[model samples]
Target: MRSFPVRLPSGTRYWTVLDEDLAVVAEADAFLRHVRFGRDQAELTTRTYAGHIALFLRWCARTGRDWRTAAEELGLFVVWLRYGTKEATGADRPSTEAGLVLAGPGAEAVRKPARIENVLTGVRQFLLHGITEKAVPSQVLALLYEVADDRDLPPEARGEGMSYRMKARHRVQVPRAPRDRATDAEIVALFLACRCARDRFIVLLLARGGLRRGAAAGLRRQDVHFMPDSTALGCHVAGSHLHVVRRENPNGAWAKRQPPGSGQPVPVDVLVVRAYDQYVLERMERPHARDSDFVLVNPQELTDLHLRFEERGGSSTPLGRPTAS
Candidate 1:
């Protein structure tokens, strides 16, 4: 309900509060800071971990139980996480009706199984951190580790994805969808929806080259090699290719799981190269273009033709992949 602001290295701020008057517990706060500044984790990772841990802390506070001594309560915690408390259930109701509900009709929105699993993972990590700190009791850890029988597992939870050692003590039954290839009509509709050559090129890089949005967004002009025998970079790839590197740009794009040195090279189809050429020659040289190394730049025109226009990298607005229905 209320938040205490925490600033990130990236100059972005996020609040760390469980409820109106309840900030994250000291142990949880220590774990969060260790993950943030100590391990140098990204802002997103820190926020996610803090949020889940805060939720668990809030539940413990409301239930009149210490988080360290309340492993068995997790069984009930999972139910409240997915379905919320029932009127028939003898669980203690919240002191205030205005508090955020985890799940139920009173909840602002529903959470998918994957989302629930992620939250559980964060709590698990928090407990693990406590174990390392020697703060959590071994009995509590063992209790949380207890698993249910195969027969007890719901139909969705019975299959191969279940962990044998861990069992099903604190797991949610997530519905899995069968993977289907995109149809020809779907692919056609995707390309037809693109408004410009830049858009088409970005889509092609994501679809064909298998480049993530961050990788595509971080690309530099020097990374794109259109020449088979170039005097400039000296390497011949026989076709147009782009190298993906881990570089933090002004626009806030970064390649995930990138190694220290040498980037990955991916060859582009001829049509993708044509799109690149069109975007570079016709669109890039427009008076609005900025003098930046980033490959993707968006232009903003000045109302007066005599005035200079503005152009910048696609950092502020992430160029997301076009979904093929």
Candidate 2:
């Protein structure tokens, strides 16, 4: 099975699962559509859920077990999820090796505990959705969750006391790791290593402006206000700042939803402003970039600039993923 992207007449996109015969899995499609339109989730969220559901469906098909039956024996699925080879999903490839050849100690598990947890979470949600739609037997809920009271809860959580909740039966214990952040020296190094003003501006925008990748990429030229006072331009906010607005970008970049009473523009430092100035000069050299309204645009192609940077490891460790301040 594979996950396929579907674009609707309204230009909204979602993901669905397709079997080996290239037929859409009816149940998976219904659930994913509900997630995308009914729940109003991001397109990427549906993609992720579709991928997870596809994996679970593939595992069930390969093991000759019905999805309902597989849910009852999810322990075996968890073990397989931890150690299963990529080739296990393919019909032509063998699932096991004949002999063990020692590889170096640096080898890591096929799937990390956190990733496994995410997969299980998606699968559980899919199963619960199926139950709500009356497609799956209600008895399967017993295997997936356990009802428990709030007797051991803290005072704040207890509320009025005697309240009960259903807890997931399957969960992976993931170890907490320190949040990775880029140091000042590393940020400087990245900025210095950039070959062009655009690249430098990208580095500064992410590191200094505290903009999320999607927000930075989704920024429009009009959203940037470099003037100290911008009453002439019609924007009320003063100082050099950039607005982070949520929009449906063709490049698949999406800004996070802003909370109520928090739609003010984000302030940018002098360095970011200076970098933007230089980037503007460089961007003007490219007709395509100059014509595009987006603040960040690829001079050579229309692909997502932030995603390209991520693919080139520009957002990797030591320069951990940028987040809004």
Candidate 3:
């Protein structure tokens, strides 16, 4: 690379502009464009990450703080963030950053919590990118590796001072996911224990349809449809197929008798419709109750029926499985 002399506000601006590195920058731009187009990331996520990376690059250039020098200046960056407003105190020198004094919760740094937290993570990622590209020093990478998890940082170091800017990281805890959904054996075990006709169908519907309890409860008498293409329907006459639902538009009907929006055809399993149909005629609908459409609730006139249903129980309602386990 040859230095080129140019006139600037600071007199002679001599720069060693390399031709090869321009191609690298162009490639990086193309990669970001590809990420925007090719992936399924939400628009906001893509924008946020891109914006943060841009800020990191700008900061790196302004401070002449490439990855190699970042390790020596890590403490300074932390101090600059904690205090040192440019308008009041002027541009902070590297040496001046070391003895930064944090006063209280009333500090300027505490004002923008979300930006402060995100910037820390963003800068860390930018430094990592430098390491991968072999632009950063090995010492910076080693120090990054040596830092304890933020949650494990010493209480003494955390005592309000420059040390409060501990290694910023997300605290990881052991995940407690939801308990075992009915396993095949559990479903079988439950079904075997039940003698009632409706109860036997319930287990099969749950396993086959993978229906949530709320969706199951939302079923109605009118939801059942025949797939047989038969004119005359007879009771107990088995057909190869049945549709559990023919969903209408949100307004309950469309001009063309289809849903208002474009929707996909989800075929209902035969066992599920058999189950839905059985509940409607036998359990839910008496002669007077037939007017109401809901399969789960009979329309028998009763005050405060809604209140009773609301108070029934949640999905996590204890089933006494703890004793056996």
Candidate 4:
């Protein structure tokens, strides 16, 4: 067991955590190995993806690059990634105990530099996810990529006597913008005209609260609780605020319910609680064929909201009342 170095943003020696049985890298690798694959095999197993992510984080720690500074200093960290992997191995894999010490000088210098490159790529992707989620600042994101150049995704496998051209074909698409945000005006307007309690609540939660749409969509009647007895509540609304936190598979579509990020409770003001209560009461009055575990019904009561928007524009309004167009 040996520890590797990491630099925290505060300028403290974050310390080397990869050592013996207590190695952080080893634990992370083990955690990733048993990850479950959802219905979509094309998507990486959560654990597998996480394994790549840890390789990056440990390297960043070793190099003293904050999440914000990673883009520019990534190459330095990338250079050392292979060494970290060689130092850490699981029972299921071939031993890499002497991986670094045994390699020739040229191999040490050029030595599967591509593997390290892939790890850096993985970290960049993870940071990008964090940025969109607001875990990291966008300025750091711009600086990190403002200087990167590469051979795209390097290959996962290589051949003994393959053609040079064939070798270069394997590459990964770098992180691209996949998330789109509603314009502030659009978001603000949605809140003003939203007649449905569910729609109105989700809009505010996302914009003002910075919550993801998925998190809002997943809220359940039980998951929501109100704070009572203070100015926090009125008599009709009682004495409680909406408790916002992680929930079961909000829609019950996925095997597990809690979203990728974390969760919490939101105590809406008096007006919001009243709207939610109204939405629930009205939802109970309707008789739909499908079952809903949701606190908010598909304004129109459609079973699938994703497809409802694409295939059935007629039901776009979610009860003929769109979230402000």
The candidate that achieves the highest TM-score relative to the unseen native structure: 2
lDDT, model 3, position 207: 79
Clashing pairs in 1: 251-315
lDDT of each residue in 1-325, candidate 4, tens digit only: 2324433464322222243355575433332322322223111334335555655554444444564556566554545553334443322223435323233455544335555456555556556656665766876566445432233335544334442331211133344557887898997787889776667766765565555555565565555655565443322334454434543342422223333433344455665666667666766654441245565566453544434555656542443321211
Kindly report which residue stretches of model 1 are placed more than 4 angstroms away from their true locations once superposed.
1-19, 22-26, 36-41, 85-109, 146-168, 229-239, 288-290, 301-325
lDDT for each residue of candidate 3 in 1-325, tens digit (9 for 90 to 100):
1112223363322121112233223323333333334433223333454454444343444466663456555555554444645432222232435424445666666324456456556556555655666766656766554544434456764545433233433322334567777677887798789665456555665577554443444445444443554235442323433223323222222111223332222345766667656654554433334334544442332213433444675342322211100
Off by over 4 Å in 4: 1-186, 193-195, 208-210, 227-239, 247-263, 288-291, 302-325
Candidate 1 per-residue lDDT, tens place, 1-325, comes to: 2224586687654445445445455677777777756765655576788777766776676666788876677867666566644331212344465333455356542456787788788888788778888889766677657644566566786767544446535777678889786665876688779887777777777777778888888888788887665546865555678778776465556677655555777787887777788777745444434345677866332112213212333342223321111
Model 1 lDDT on a 0 to 1 scale: 0.64
The TM-score values for the models, in the order shown, are: 0.70, 0.79, 0.31, 0.35
- What TM-score should be assigned to candidate 4? 0.35
Predicted model with the maximum lDDT: 2
Ten-residue region with minimum lDDT total, candidate 1: 301-310
Best of the two (1, 2) by lDDT: 2
lDDT of 2 at 88: 66
Model 1, residue 318: what's the lDDT?
A: 27
Root-mean-square deviation (CA) per prediction: 7.8, 8.8, 20.9, 19.0
- Poorest stretch of ten by lDDT in candidate 4: 34-43
